[model samples]
Structure formats: structure tokens, C-alpha cells
Target: MALAVRQACIRAVIDGYQQAAISGLCPEGAFEAAVDAVRMLDMAAVLQREETAACAAGTENIRREPGSVR
Candidate 1:
């Protein structure tokens, strides 16, 4: 699911770049910036997912342990 989201984001950026280029409104270095933005977003998404998973695991462990209080 995360991979799909990342791919979609990249595709959107590419499409935007192409459209901007065709309209002659794409500033120099804008495409690189867009790509960098996508990478940062993807990394953030990954970190969020990892944190969520860790939290879920901790919750489960607490639930399974005897006398563990929330």
C-alpha cells in the first residue's frame, strides 16, 4: 500500500512536470525539487508506518502480559 502511494506520488510529479514544461512555465530546478519533495514524503510515510506498527505491537504485548495495565 505504501509502495502504491509512493508510485502514485512520483507519477503525479512527473505528469505535473511534463505539463509545466509544455506550457513553458516550469522554472529551472523545479523538477528536481519536486522529486526531492516526493522522496521526503515517501520517507515520512515509511517512518509513520514503522511507528504505528511499533505502537500496535507494544499495545498487543501489554494486553498479553499478566497484570499489564494500559
Candidate 2:
């Protein structure tokens, strides 16, 4: 991810923490939830990248098939 995107993600996490703090949730719980959200986001990005790479790899196999038209 670009630096700008990473910074925005960090900003969002901090904002969530602040919102939780204002809503009377305990700091520890809020922190844990915020961290979990970040983890989920990271996982999603990783999955997307892996899917893209797999698709690219599969194309190579397709083009190599004897009857392939590409």
C-alpha cells in the first residue's frame, strides 16, 4: 500500500480509539477492538494481493496449453 493509504489507515484507527474513549468504553477494550479492525484490514489486503498473483500465474498455464487460442 502507498504511504498515504497507510497514514490514512492509522488516522482512522486513532479516530476510532478516540470515539470509543468519548463513548465511555474502557481504554483497553477500545484499544483491542481497534487493533482487531486493523488486523482484519491487513488480512483483506493480503488476500487481494494473493488472489491477483494467483490469477496472473494461472494465465501462464492457460497460454501454454496445446489447444489454447491466446
Q: Please report the candidate that would top TM-score against the real structure.
A: 2
lDDT of 1 by residue, 2-31 (tens): 665666687767866676667675566558
Candidate 2 structure quality by residue, lDDT tens digits, 1-70? 3554576568668877887778888989789767765665664665567668778988777646577567
Q: For candidate 2, which ten residues in a row score worst on lDDT?
A: 1-10
- Superposition error at 21 for model 1 (Å): 0.4
User: What are the lDDT scores of the predictions, listed in order?
Assistant: 0.66, 0.70
Model 1 steric clash pairs: none
The CA lDDT at 59 in model 1 is 75
Q: Could you tell me every candidate's TM-score relative to the true structure?
A: 0.39, 0.46
Off by over 4 Å in 1: 29-70
TM-score of 2: 0.46
Looking at model 2, residue 59 earns an lDDT score of 78
